[model samples]
Target: MTESPVLMSVDDRGIATATLNRPALGNAYNGEMLDALIEGIPRLAADPAIRGLVIRGAGKHFQAGADIHWLSAAAAAPPEQAFASSLQTTRAMQLLNEFPKPSFAVIHGACFGGGTGIACCVDVALATTQASFGITEVRVGVAPTPISTHMVHAMGLRHARRYAITGERFGPEEAMRIGLVHEVHAPEAVEARLEEIVAAMLLSSPAAIAVTKTSLLESNGLALSAHQVTQLTNESWMVRAGKEGKEGLAAFREKRKPAWA
Candidate 1:
């Protein structure tokens, strides 16, 4: 039997962990993974026994972004399916960004595209010193619209504009400097640090934490509306099915510069 794309568990202490499980693909997301997150986050959120959530990726890399082959296939899919694909991506990010409980991301290895988006949405992001970060959707000619809002919220507009457009890879320190991550530690110490943080989170009032988080996002206009998500999803799917998206994916697979480059 095939293993699930996402593995989720809650410990006796009521701390939940969601692991992106496609190690063979560097945890690059596909529809199954996105749907798992779309379904799982809310279930966990509604559980009174669950105090907080932690996001992580299994194996050598955290998440390398969407699987390119999947992107190519989605681009060729029927319009409704393609549109829904983009919607899944957009909705998953929005759910995490607005999750009711305190949430944390423990990042290591490669973190790109949607991975960076996950980092952006979490209340706390802890990365290993050796982790690499990038908002690289543009490299494949697909707009990073799904992640754009969170990127701007996590890092400032100036920083998000540069990285999302350029698709440059930066190290953990640079990630911290840009406000994408809260702390960077040696790989061996990162898990320890996360345990410390989660313990601290558990000590706080869960209801108060939820209230404060909601207020902060609403006051700053970080709360996303359904129409906004639809607009983003439309832009994302339109580009994936366009000429530039086709050429870009081809160039990447062929290991060559795109025509525009």
Candidate 2:
């Protein structure tokens, strides 16, 4: 039997951890991974015993983003399916970003593309000194509509525009400097720091945390409407179905510069 692409557990302290489990692929997301996240996050959130969430990647990497072959296939799917694929990506980020409980990410290794999105959505993010980050969707010829708002919210417009468009890989310090992550430490110390943060979070009231997060997002206009979600999903699906997306995915798979480049 195939192993699950995502694994989740909650501790006695009500701290939930979601492990992205596609280690051979750097925990890159495919349809199954996305589906797992879409299902798992809410289930954890609804559990009264669950006080907070921590996201981690199994094996060597936190997350490397979408599996290119799966993404290429998605770009080739029927229009409705293509749209649904985009929706899955969008919804996963939304659910995590809007999670009532405090959310955190412990990032190491490659945190690229949607991995960066996960870092951005979390209330607090910590990374190992060796971790690397990039917002590289454009490099593969697809726009990052799904994570766009979260990127801006986390890192601000000036930083987001530069990195998201350039697809430059940055180390953990740079990620911290740009506000993508809150702290950077040697791999040995990162987990200890995360535990400290989670412990502090548990001292606070869960209901207060939820209200504060919701009010902050809504007051800042970070809360997305259903129509806005549709716009993001539609734009993502349309672009992935377009010529540039096709060419980009092909070029990435072929290990060459895209035609436009």
Candidate 3:
């Protein structure tokens, strides 16, 4: 039998961890892992015993973003069906971003694409100095719509525009400079900071943490409604079904510069 696409665990201390489990692919996302995240995150949020959450990727790299092959196939398939399927990733991000309680990410290796989105959704994102990051969707011709709002919220419009459009790879310090990450440390020190933060949350009042998180989202207008979800999904689908998305995916698989490039 195949291993589960995502692995989740909650400790007696109430620190819950959701790990993306596709290491052979640098923890890149496919449909099954996206589905697992959409299902797993909210279920953990609803559990009263859970006091905090951490998102990580298994093996070396964090998450490298959507599976390029998946996008290649998606771009070639029926638009509506492909869009709906891709929306599972959006749903997963929304659920985690809106999850109540303190959350953190211990990022290392390659935290690109959806990995950056996952980092943004958490309350605190700490990374190793060796870590690398990117908002890489445009490199392959697909829209980064699914994580756009969160990216903008985390990095602000100026930074998001520069990196999102360029799809350049950056180190953790650059990520911190742009506000995509909170703190940077040596690989050995990152886990200690993460554990310290989780421990601090464990000592706090759960009700207060939840209320504060809710109020923050509300105050910033980061919270979403059902209509917004559909709208974003539509935007994502349109881009993926467009000429650029097709060309980008093909070029990636074919290992060539896209025609426009």
Whole-structure CA lDDT of model 3: 0.88
Colliding pairs, model 2: none
lDDT of 1 by residue, 1-261 (tens): 989999999899999999999999999999999999999999998999999999999999999999999899999888899999999999999999999999999999999999999999999999998899999988889999999999999999999999999999999999999999999999999999999999888889999999999999999899999899999999999999999999999898899999989
lDDT of each: 0.95, 0.93, 0.88
lDDT of 2 by residue, 113-180 (tens): 99999999999999999899999999989999999999999999999999989999999999999899
45 in model 2: Cα distance from truth in Å? 1.3
What TM-score does prediction 1 earn?
0.98
What is candidate 2's local distance difference test score?
0.93
Off by over 4 Å in 2: none
Write the number of the candidate with greater lDDT, choosing between 1 and 2.
1
